[model samples]
Target: MNDTAHALGASRTLWELAERRAALTPDRPVLLQGDRSLSFGELRERAERVAAGLYGMGVRPGTVVAWQLPTRIETALLSFALVRLGAVQSPVIPFYRDHEVGFALRESRAEFFAVPGTWRGFDFAAMARRLGAKGVFEAYDGEGLPDGDPAVLPPPPAEGTSVRWIYWTSGTTSDPKGVLHTDRSLIAGGSCLAHALHLSPDDVGSIAFPYAHIGGPDYTVMLLLYGFPAVMFEQFALPDALEEYRRHGVTVAGGSTAFYSMFLAEQRRRPGGKLIPTLRLLAGGGAPKPPELYHSVVREMGVQLTHGYGMTEVPMITMGSPDDSAENLASTEGRPPEGMEIRIVDGEVRLRGEAVCQGYLDPAQTEEAFDENGFLVTGDLGRLTADGHLVLTGRLKDVIIRKGENISAKEIEDLLHRHPAVQDVAVIGLPDEERGERVCAVAEQAPGTAALTLAAVTAYLRAEGLSVHKLPEQLEVVDALPRNDTLRKVLKYKLRERYSGTVK
Candidate 1:
């Protein structure tokens, strides 16, 4: 649509785009949570009211406001309100407890903290008080969301490059780092995802992950640009939520690799039938997708599974298109958008683009992250193919050095995913005196399947023509891999801690 391009090309700030889209499609559905839907027109009107109320609470331009809320319509409303007022917004994942929450509030020096009073049986207000959070208020249950006349609202933000979003890293390995983002950067990221998917106004999408995640805005901007609707799941669970997916006739569905695995598992329960009849594509990013999983989905689920590469710093870096070759979709993380620049320096993926974040909240960390050429050091070990598709090997720190030889965890994990008995697996390096580090594979067995052993795994890898040294030397089976609350990415650091023997 020409309007979509105009919004992507011309709008400087998110509020401007929201307003422009609202003018174009006032009554079109945008954010849908079950029976409740917020049209573009309502987004502008309600955000203005919320912004006015926040201003009444002394939340002036440049004010820092922090909120820890779940994936819900109210959360989006609060975030857009901050954008409307040009205030810096730091959204914490609802699952983060006081330890991370306190650090974010104190580090950001936030003027206010918003929380759900008693969401998921936890009293966030009590934690806010315990942490001595400033300007604490309940933002849900229709009790205390900022409310006032839209007539009192100030003009919406015009600048897009200013730092307005603060998203924290998952913090699996260390203290979470605060990554700063902007409207233009987020818009650029969202545009890449939208165009790559080739969505239409009649198409319907769904959100299966947390709304506070960076992907939230990335998906929201897609709706605004393309004039489509997406179902928002407050709490996503399989079979239970499958009814909703079918009810909405969702055309595109997926959160990440974990989400794809979850869908595949459900499909396996009842094979030879479409999980959602209307579903045509499964698209997502934020975690690695195994090649076998792609083949299985296309072969069984009867839908295209296009994965991509994205991080909190840059919500969307590259995205797999539906029209790409099966081999390309299975092996690569798609190609970068027109503005994105990807470089592989010593196997570390480096990026420089408008979609990239400004930097971290700490100046020193920011300085350390960017190279002299202003490229953001992604820390991810990867290489660009001849056609420019990114193929990530593993994290630079995640490489296991075994007797002076580096073992890529991703390569092993991808191979292991093909094994029938292995439901999900994580390859971690455990310390050993002789080998320096030993390759270990921890796996979750498929339902009703026999247990997998180290010998069997090694033999399978060997049969598949894997290097002898690259085959896992140790194997451990678990009920489930230790994963973070959001996106359910395997926490290999936790695995290392669990498997780390008493040695250097």
Candidate 2:
């Protein structure tokens, strides 16, 4: 392993690092959204202009700039611009409705906001206007921002200087908590991930995940930090993604496990159509990988599939590296990065690392997140194998205890996803009269496939050696599952709202 300590001893602030990289690789393509392409030099120049514009609007160091924009080159540039001006950025997912957006803006206490006039079939300018009228946010126009010379801007004063980014977690049981990350942490996590994925300047990354999420920001930072080219897609349509991959020769692409499943489905429909020949890695997160989906990608798409495990609190905790065995990729979230530590207490996963977030925006939540020993109690149930691989069971809070028997919803869901007819599944604990709680499986079947019944699914589970108690008591087949932007996470609470009464 390369000595991270020696390599990062002279690390600079986020902006300084980006600027130094831009100077080193001036003519390299930094971002590509559709036909638009910006070289590193061009990207740096645009970021400086945007920084000057923010400065003109009285956005100084430590000012919070809330942005609700789609995945675009402008969003990437403006984010870097905020870092250059020493202002913190809070990027809300573009799909967030008014209530969610209003809450995040109020919670973060942002002074300025940036969004595209319109993007990807949505009118963000209209959304901004509505938010402005309600006094929800102070909006700025990114399209009209002027360009300035990047060399004129001063570097950040010191390393570890605060450059905050507030991202909300998809709270399953409670309101979303704002996870506050520093520039140092973001850069460190992104650097480690870039190395693990073996990304290079020549690699073109297709980013379909929302920029409001951690994966989006991580990819953007990786591209900038390593001088890699990125093709930003506003949405994750499989056809559009395939076209982009072919057009850009994209090598590294990733999002949720569901996205990969959908991509494979599309690939099956279009036989003999291979667009991404240079594609080397397909990274997934936000949920466990279905064994079927993993095999499909390896057999059909001809790419290495990697699963990443982490939350907004401690982003990039574990990842299935590019060099990992296929069995490791299918079973574990690979190993922790060089300087990270992971342990299991009782059944909950805990982590301590430089990449971990400082704390929540709310002190009370922060206090609840960390135990007395200062390790961030991840609230995730996982165990480490003797060889040091991390096997995630499920969320500690989401485990289903039926008559004193603990059942992992993830285990059931993984088995369900392997069923030939099952496209996706989410297992949740529903209230029970006798047992404390029973498992209910909500599934979405593959298109054109016959409808699946609970009995059939149970038969498959039985054949797979699942105990009778572990099988879901009830199954609800649906057209689609509610998912976050990444499509990997199923909003179980939503399922609870709709199907809790159906559990036996």
Candidate 3:
């Protein structure tokens, strides 16, 4: 391996450090999924077996291997195994249907696939086989596969050699885009995240987010780099997660607003209840977190609530550090971590840093995403505070122009979420003949709560002293809000699809 300091610019790649840690803590638990646990040595052995298996299958360096598996021990092992073999991984959420899976496969040009036969009552093998026939690689069965002899592969030629992963965007906006990340970028991002969270070898991180997302992968890499143990949960159930946190002594965890809400609901169900005491930090991102949820997490759980703002193209651009003020933690996505630069132009957020992805796989997209100056123009609309923190206003495309006023949909949605009966809310702009465009709010009411009328919503906005133009002219109550895998982010584009022209 290259010099640890040089490979990471100042540190080592997570896999590189993991090998050293495995030798140091061979019998220590490195991964836990349900009742099954794998020690560091066992995990390394299994990864070597998987690497040998891939070698036997004729997979070589630079090959793309797509994986769609739950957050199981094998999933973690296989992911590292692909890295050990110098292959790039493209992880897709297990919940992705055929259409989504096919889109990712096509975008990444994946040549090999790894999937579970069955997980959480779903038949992934059958589902995968059907999709594999359409062009993707055939799914390999992890359970019945033989453990081949251990074999070591050459390390990457050098830092930033070639692409290490092709991570797909969350697709909350339009079609999913593939973002290429080199080993240098991945190591930098992981180190930044680990430093931001103040993670150490004794820390045990419990991840509720899907492994397919950037947040999950970054968290995993951070923990492994620090030689910390991580607890992976396949499904997101608040009570079960709480039990796991308490059982595993999990120190750090992260999820979306929906997860915090579920955890809050569970806490209310018990007498004088609270989240596990071992949880030192609770982080939420991928969407705007309600102030009430933030307050509750800090008040009830005795843990700080933090939020991060980033995209797949630039993961962990800004996050609230553990030392940040409570108001900073609650009000904005804290300043950029070390070795990163962020700026605001015409209300659009732009980024430039070592942690930024190389570029999109599509040449056109790569050209479009970055400007001539090489700064990535994030489609997000936000402003940098005087203190350098980022306050997200709304998405640039989601801006509502009614008459002549530019209305921020996120501002209105944040107001609506504060309503007593509103459990979740999303704001979008719909076509309007006279006004140019009108503001619309789609909300999901709390359980057993009565539906809200447009007039009532308008009255609430007026009572809160919001400007007339900021009030949503139209409101729709639905059983549930359409969200991406994290369940924290609202798919406003989908809302636009359903109600863009239907609004009166």
Candidate 2 per-residue lDDT over residues 1-504, each given as its tens digit: 234322432356667666676787889997787787988887777788878766766777788888887777777777888877888888887877666777777788878776655666777667666666222222333345545554555555365546478888876666678898887788667766775776666678877888768876676667766677888887778675677778888888778787788778777887785647788788867777766678888888888888888778877888888788888888888888777888799988898887889889999999998888889998889899887889998888689999999999988988887787988889998888899898888888888887899889999999999999998888888889987665457788899888776735
What number of clashing residue pairs does each candidate have, in the order they appear? 0, 0, 0
Q: Rate the local accuracy (lDDT) of all candidates.
A: 0.89, 0.77, 0.75
- What's the ranking of the predictions by lDDT, best on top? 1, 2, 3
lDDT of 3 by residue, 1-504 (tens): 123322333534445655765776788787776777888787777888877777777667778888887766667777777777778889888877777787887778788776666667777767767766232332333464325666445553344446888888766546778889876677666666766676667778777777777776677656556667888887877676678888889887777677767766676677475567687787656777756667777887677777787677777788878788888887788778767888788889888998889998899999999987889998898888888888888778878999999998878877787787898888888999989998888998877766799999999999988898788888888889887665466777788889976846
- Pull out the clashing pairs in model 1: none
Q: How far is 55's C-alpha from truth in model 1 (Å)?
A: 1.0
Better by lDDT, candidate 3 or 1: 1
Best candidate (score: TM-score) = 1
Per-candidate TM-scores read 0.98, 0.93, 0.91
Candidate 1 vs 2: which has more lDDT:
1
What digit string (tens of lDDT, one per residue) describes model 1 on residues 150-203?
A: 787777776899998899888865789999999999999888898789889899
lDDT of 1 at 34: 73
